[model samples]
Target: MKRDRSGHFLMAQNARVLYVPTTKVASSTARLLLAEANGTYRPERLRWTDAPNISVDQGIHNLEVSGLQYFEFLPETQRDHILKSSNWWRVGLLRDPYARLYSVWENRVLLRAPSPWLKNFQHKCSEVLIDGRLDYAASFRKFVNVLRAEPEIFGDDPHFKSQRTHLGGDQVAFTHLFRVDKPGELDIFATQLGQRVGMKIEPRRLNEGLGLKHLDVMDAQTASVVEQIYEDDFDAYGFERVSFPSISPIALASVGETKAINYARDVTARLVQLSQLARYRQRSRYLLAQILRNSGLRRHKKHR
Candidate 1:
């Protein structure tokens, strides 16, 4: 799971659709939709009673909980068929490189989202977290610098890794590649996917981690580093580059306000995660059940 090419690729065999999820590109929304199509999206299965909907929404990333099929788990013959057959709609979602990098900093570094991989980042770039305490701009710049020094150090953790790494370049031959940043693209996809599945399929959005714009934190130096890091994405996706003014007082104030609110949210989420971990036996049983279900050792009827 920590490797550069961990098996994040998924597919809906019945729908004849293959999905290559690029992190931070509405990938969660796409995964939920595909799970629905596969008749395996069971919100009740999450069993996090405190906030059922939110917990289930976030759980879509788990292949076992979501009940979606991992493309890598399929047989070679089946994988070949899905890739070659025109019947299968191989889908991908893209985002602006600039926007995507900023999101990584804002959500993972700034908001301190509760994730297992988060600790690895903190240990590697402690400066980002320490500087983040007082100066958001300096923290972001430090993060970009760390990323430039060792781009693949996180082992292709989806959040910090390039979209190109996940997309499986040339081998995937994605039939439908949509830019999530573009207006109405996801809506169009929703309609198309709904028609294919014979039901309404709305793209579920989550993790609106920050209200402040990327320009608020990013400066010329940080922006330049981001460009260098993700230049391939801009060229391959044909996304136009954007410029940012060095500073904006109004935006800076907004960043400060948002930081305070997000800090509280992050602490709450971490406390919840800790609470779950406290129930050692219950947590162990739950994880065992999930693994059994995912590995086909236990029977779980597909949800439609």
Candidate 2:
């Protein structure tokens, strides 16, 4: 479940832009790219000292530094201004719901890096933890059950929440929107967005390593259930249901070898998660310094 991920939003005042983030749709990569464009992103990935949160350096973050603020974390005054910004570019992204859930399963259960609320969710679902790991195959149906049955429980977690709602639902405030499943649409949006922001944005892949097989785990019943669960996303976003490619049972029926493969896959997933922290740290410090300098000048001019 590429869930709500602490329910964050990104903004870049210098760029006259606001971004509403949805998980498993390349939100992290978008955030970094936006920060770089705003000229305030630090190369180093720092810990969030304010709470038990793993985040980029908060000191050089926010509206002051990066011109980006976490929507849910910001004060109401700031949030209201951004959300209601008609003049600014309000943007959002979406992914196929099935794809998002599969990524979530790989990231949280296999990779062992999850949002804070995910553990509680795991506890409520099936597949008892075995040797500090979840039974990935067993969890999908149960997870979908939870998605349908107790939607309110997933209200805060966008990973599993409807993309329609995360992208502002029927209110539909976004001036620019993109879909991960459609590369051509993404390219068209990126080209136009770059012209508006006065910089080239070559969309880079981020937060991906999982294969397409996540969707195939769905049997007919589960597929129908998920389609219903995310029906809003399908309708609102103009997306169609994905018919995952089915593999023959004989090919996947090797029980002993499958166990080994699952273990290896899980181990690889964990390594990728660990390396991302270092990757975040390597962003250019020039961006952060530029925002600080320009912001200070703006404030000084206002006073004068």
Query: Candidate 1 residues 130-205, lDDT tens each?
Result: 3234455666677889889976666535688778877976678888998887898988888898898799888867
| Candidate 1 ranges beyond 4 A from true positions | 1-6, 48-54, 123-135, 150-156, 246-304
What is the lDDT, from 0 to 100, of the residue 280 in candidate 1? 67
lDDT values, one for every candidate: 0.73, 0.61
* Ten residues in sequence with the least summed lDDT for candidate 1: 126-135
lDDT of 2 at 81: 72
True-structure RMSD, every candidate: 6.4, 10.0
lDDT of 2 by residue, 1-304 (tens): 4533325556676776778777677776676667766766654434422221223432333344344766566676876676676777888877877777778655654444535455455455544334545445556666777777876654455567677666766443677777767657666656766787788886656556444355446765667778898888778767777664344111132355446546765665465566555455544454666677788843333664
The estimated TM-scores of all candidates read: 0.78, 0.64
- Span of ten consecutive residues with least summed lDDT in model 2: 245-254
